[model samples]
Target: MALREQLDADMKTALREKDSLKLSTVRMIKSAMKYKETEPGAAGPLDDAGILQVITSEIKKRRDSVTEYEKAGRSDLADKEKAEIAVLQHYLPEQLTAAELEKAVADAIAEAGAEGPRDMGKVMKVLTPRIQGRADGKVAADLVKQKLAT
Candidate 1:
């Protein structure tokens, strides 16, 4: 099923189960997707990859919120954000393990002929699409840096 259909089905299930957290998170994601659809020059409905991109962006926002809440010593709010992250994560592809990510970065570096830190851009250009929503950009970049530095 398409992401739209899947989300709709899940939203109905959440409603039936009276899962307030899940209902709110699904609504938030739906709102974001609606905004994307209405954006200037948007080509109408988003494909699976586009939906995944949106989901990933939402996850990132929740993670940032969690960090801010933690720093402000609001464990309550941080826990909420973490819960939202967990709910949203169900739609995303399985994340790459550290070793898998390392291998992917190494492969990109080799394929891009990236020999030094200066070639980071080249490696990232070749690597980003492959990892996409499956890996955290910051973690993958750090891994790339570690590999390059060695």
Candidate 2:
């Protein structure tokens, strides 16, 4: 099934099960997708890839919130953010292992003939589409920098 259908099914399931956290998170995802659809120049309703992008963005935001909440010694809030992360993560493609990501970076570097940091853009251009929601962009960029620096 497509992601949108899956989301719909999950939304129904959440409602039936009375899973408030899950229901809220699914609603939030739907809201984000709707916002994206209505954004200026949006190309109509989001496809699975676009939905995944939104889900990934939501996960990233929660991760940042978790960090801030932790810093303020708000364990409760941090835990809630973490739970939300878990809920959002359920929709993501299987994440790349660190080794897999490193290999992918190496492959992209070679494919792009990226000799140094200056070629970061080229490498990323080739890399980003491959990793997409499967890997974190920041971590991938850092790996690229580290590999290129050596």
The reply for model 2, stretches above 4 Å from the true place, is none
**How would you encode candidate 1's per-residue C-alpha lDDT over 31-140 as one tens digit per residue?**
99989989999999988889988999999999999999999999999999999999999998899998899889989999999889999999999999999989999899
**Best candidate, TM-score:** 2
Q: What is the TM-score of each candidate against the true structure?
A: 0.96, 0.98
lDDT of 1 at 29: 94
User: Which segments of candidate 1 are over 4 A away from where they belong?
Assistant: none
Which pairs clash (backbone N, Cα, C closer than 3 Å) in model 2?
A: none
lDDT of 1 at 111: 99
lDDT of 2 by residue, 17-125 (tens): 9999999999999999999999999999999999999999999999999999999999999999999999999999999999999999999999999999999999999
Question: Poorest 10 consecutive residues of model 1 by lDDT?
Answer: 141-150
